[model samples]
Target: MKMNKNYCFIYSLFFFVVSMFFFLFGISIGFKSMIYILEWELINLNSSSVCFSMLLDFKSMIFMSFVLFISCMIIFYSNLYMNLDYNKNRFIILVVLFVFSMMFLIISPNLMSILLGWDGLGLTSYCLVIYYQNSKSYSAGMLTILMNRVGDVCMLMSIAWMLNFGSWNYLFFYYNENLSLELNMIVFLVLLSAMTKSAQIPFSSWLPAAMAAPTPVSALVHSSTLVTAGVYLLIRFSNLIFMAEMNNYLLMIGCLTMFMAGIGANFEFDLKKIIALSTLSQLGFMMSTIGLGFPDLAFFHLLTHALFKALLFMCAGVFIHNLNNLQDIRGMGCLVNQMPFISICFNFSNLALCGMPFLAGFYSKDLILELSLMMYMNKFIFILFFMSVGLTVMYTFRLIYYTMSMDFNYNSYFILNDEELQFIIPMFFMVLMSIFGGSFLGWMMIDIPELIIMSSWSKYFVLMIMLIGGWIGFELSNLNLLMNSLYLTNKKLVFFIGNMWFMPYLSTYMMNYYFLIVGNKIFKSADSGWLEEMGSQGMKKIFDVMFKKNQNFQDVEFFIYLVSFFMWIMILFFLIIFKM
Candidate 1:
């Protein structure tokens, strides 16, 4: 026990010091793009298996600095957050390793070297997500690891494909216009890996469920580092990845994810889950921007979003920690009067997330929307984009109104206060940066791409969406513009909208229900229906759990929405763009 304690503390500090060095080093590099790659050819090693190296450009440096800075703060916050735990040392060790793994991923350009980091991120996140050692955490962990394994398999397939291309280093292949079928497949595999890592649509359930982990871990892993890995990877690979077919697919999936997550967030009762869905929405926004041929804009948003989103998580942590782990937002209200400092943090982050001009998220998000309008695609896609943005504001306003605007709704016996120094210190820095991170990065990263405005209608799109969404949020959440019967009559529709368009059902059950059925029968045959040997007990439990989760899945389905949407989207798109 003593050794575990010392080992984690010493190493965390060591990493903290190293992080400061790299952060300063990164800042000193100061928007000056640098290339550092290392290669070693060993005669004893197979030719194709030789080690390839790292790529440290301006983006990597800035991103690394932000990641390490946030990580260091999270580690400090965890000291107080996890002080009561007996396994604090183990937890800290996992976090440091997670940080190290992200750093490796950021620095490496070689597919082989990057895998070391990518796989490490998957495994460490699995460890972190399941750290509570309870049934809930265990289930979340299984989902997290399984979804990640899909990515790992895709990466392995990519590496195998790249082998025929003569090198393990894939950085060189991004712009090869003349390519074989196998090389094109490599792009698909890479896209799959990014989507899975980032928890984009159809693989997104694990993220919201992963709130089963501790809050500090949530702040680090979910908001800033782990999920962002895919976006970073895509940015690295974007030159070759924006295929017309693939980009269209990405646009659809990403917009759908953004739309679904926004609706989910608005309906989300749990505070943490709402934030988790918001993160999901942001991930979709980034991916869609990449599809829109603005990977640099995507990266810019990625960095800015990280600054405030991490702050948002930390603020939520303060409240959750104080409310004794109470997470339902209905159980919380009018917090601004009580935890004034935290309310500021929460509000700033939320506003920033809404891209409410001048904050970290605004610089990128506004640019993203403007770019979306400029594109010559099916107008419904553009509508989906704006509608998603509006939904983002809607949910954000809903969350704020519920938690900050009304009188306190928590149990009278439960107490809330701003008492923890560790929590306060981390948030103070994060809040200040959230106010300015976007503007700073926007200047540092690139000149804001000149937006091609389509018309007067396009010019006012952002303002219109935000105002309408914000107005609807306050009205719907508080004033009750409509009666309960509307919802009661359309209960299935409401249910589907609220459940993130039932993405969890689509991701988890539909993928495995069939396989689980077969496994159950096989288990019955192998163990004579005992269901105890050959890990049949585990499989049986998993089957039962999934079945119960899926039983209530059909109030509405995405398929229903999809079929109907095809019929109306064209009409709606024209109306939207021409200001009808």
Candidate 2:
């Protein structure tokens, strides 16, 4: 225990120091508009060379710095969160490894090196997700890893496709004006890979399921860093996506993901899952922003979102810990009375999530929405965007009402308070970031002021939608028995929207069940039945009959008698001829 505590402090300080250094370096790089590439040749073949390379620019350095910083905080927080657990040392090690994997991914411009980090993330996340050593954790881990494998496969295909260009370094092609048709296909594959990683649409089931992990892991991995990897990848390849003319498709998917996750969160009861859905919605927002030809805005939102979301999860961790691991929001109410400081922090982060004015989320989110409104898009996209925005606020309001306003529904023996410095200290830093990170990041990221032209009605549209959404959320939270029955009368509708449009079912039981049925039929009709008889079994029977016939011909007595009789016949014939 002493040793583990030492390890935690040591790593925490190490990561914190390194993170500050990287942040300063990133700022300098950005100001100077500098890029540094370091490469070492691993293997050289005819006309193709594989080299390990790192791209050190403002983007990579800043992202790496943020990841490490969050990692440092989460590690310090975990020292208290996982104190009673037997394998806290192992937990800390896995987290450190996960951070390193993310760092590798952020810096690598080569697909091969990217794969190393990509696979590292997948593997470490699986280990972390299953760290609880139980059936639920095991199931969640399996689902998480399997869903992620789809993206890994897509990434591998893209890597192989890049081999056609005689190099796997994607940095060379990032700014290529005259790209070939094959490059488009590679970009398409890369897009699919990013979608799966980011949990867009059909691949989104795994994010909520990943709540099986410990809350610190949830804070660091799921909410902030791990889920954003796909968005980061797409941001890097934004130029390629535009060149391939796939931005519209990406835009469509991103919008749908936003809408779907937003709706799901409004109906979700699990505390962690609601937050997970929120993360998904924000990821979609990032994707859509990138799709609209604004990677800078997306990156801006990504960084800000990371700060608040991590804080949100950290506050949630304290709640769950105090409640004895009860994560159902229905059982929590008036928590502010017991834990005032945490409640304040939680509310601040929540409001930040809703893009409240002057908060971290507002600077990025409002800018993205306004800029998107400036773009010429169809009615479907426009409606989806607004609806998604409304739903986000609706869910946030609903969550706050259920957990903070209603009467406490848990056992009276519960002991909840804001006394843990380990938890509060990390969350406090994030709270500071959540309050001011966006404006600071905006200044650094946006080199030029964007010209957003719109009418008064258009300008006020977001505020109007948010007001309406908040009202609906309040009304829904106060639903009477009659209203509940009327609203939930169509259980099927509730089920569909509430479960991410049945993505988990499709990804798991629905898809797997059909394939298993086909496989079972094939096994029964062929392998165990007809094929068994006609294949090896029938061949064995034919061989048996041939063996029996050969046995008769090879009888020793029969062969000797036949030879003697033939010899006597030849002798008699010769004697008769001689007598004549």
Candidate 3:
């Protein structure tokens, strides 16, 4: 126990100091060109060499600083969260590896080195997902790794194709856009890889299923770094993919993912899954913002979202731990009274998620909406953007109503409290950041507001959407306002929305079902049927029949052998006499 605490403290301090140093370093590098680590080569392949290279610019340093800071706080929080577990050391070590991989990804300018970090995240995250040692954890871990492997393979393909460009160091081309034909395909492959990592559309089922992981792992993977990896990659390569056909496809897909996740979150019963869907929704939102040529805005939302979402997961972890692993929100009620402090933090985080004014989400989401409207685009995109934004509020309000309606659905000895020192210490910092992150990030990121200026009614459009969304959420939650049979009335629609439109089934079954069926058929035909008849089994049977036939000829065979031996002796004796 002492060893655990000591390790945690030492790691936390080291990360904290590193974060500060990076932040100071980033501030000092005002408007300078990117600095590369060009000291030595890590590998050589004939004319081309793989080198140990890093890119230190404002973007990387700032992002790295924030990632490290969150990791520092989370590690400290884990010291308390994992105090009872004997495998706490293993958990801590995995987390360290996980965070280190993320940092490596942030700084790497070479595709090969970035792949090292990318594959490391997939591997460590799989281990972390299955840390619970249960059947559910195993399945979830397999799903997580398989989904991420798509991205890994895509990245490897990109690296292979990049060899045509002579150098894997992409910093020179990053500022421009493309290198040529081969490099353009590399850009396309990178986008596809990011989509899987970011949980966009068809690749999205794995994020919710990943809830089988420990909530702390969820906090890290879903909230801040891992899920956003795709968007970050897009942002990093924003110049290359701009205005391409694939870029437009990505924008549309991102919008659809947002809409789907919003509806799914409203219908989700499990607290963690609801939050996971929300993360999916927000990832779509960020990707769409990048699509709209506002990657800086997407990045702003990404950072702000990370702060509040991490806090939200930490609070969810607290709730799950206290409720004895009961995650169904239907059984939860009266949290406002039982856990007032937690209720406050939950409300704060949820409000931020809903884009409440002056909160973290507002700073980014508001601009995205205004930009969507201001852009001379068609009506379809505008509606999708607003609908997605409204759904964010609707689901958030539904979650709040379910948890705080003063009804005590759970009849157990369990009691929820926010008094634990472990809970309070980590949460306090996140709570403070959730409160101030938007304004701070806004001041730093946006030089010119460029907010849309339209009719008076247009300025309040975002507010109107939130208000209407909240009202619908209220009606949905209140039993007195609607009949209980409403769900049955729209059964098909409810199921489609409630089950995320069967996306999980499609992603899982559609991918493996046909392949498994064909594989089984081949196995039966080759191994069990025709091959057995043609192989050693059939050969042994034929030899046995021949031996039986030979037994009938045993006496005749002996006579022939005796005659042949006499003839050989006579021939030899005659030859010896002739020689003499």
TM-score versus the correct structure, for each prediction: 0.85, 0.90, 0.88
lDDT score, candidate 1, position 108:
82
What C-alpha lDDT values do all the predictions have? Answer: 0.82, 0.90, 0.84
- For candidate 2, the 10 contiguous residues with the lowest summed lDDT are 173-182
Model 1's TM-score against the true structure: 0.85
Ranking by lDDT: 2, 3, 1
lDDT of 1 at 254: 89
Question: What residue pairs are clashing in model 2?
Answer: none
**Per-residue lDDT of candidate 3, residues 205-303 (tens digit):** 899999998888888887667897788888888877873445677778889999999988987889999999999999999988888788888888998
After superposing candidate 1 on the true structure, give the runs of residues whose Cα lies further than 4 Å from its correct spot: 1-20, 27-32, 41-46, 174-177, 243-245, 447-457, 480-487, 519-580
Candidate 1 clash pair list: none
Best model per TM-score: 2
Candidate 1 lDDT over 489-535, as tens digits, reads: 88888898887667677667876786777777787787665446436
**Cα lDDT for residue 277, model 1?**
92
> Which segments of candidate 3 are over 4 A away from where they belong?
31-39, 172-180, 243-245, 480-483, 520-580
Order the numbered candidates by TM-score, best leading.
2, 3, 1
RMSD in Å for model 1 = 22.2
C-alpha positional error of residue 95 in candidate 1 after TM-score superposition, expressed in Å = 0.8
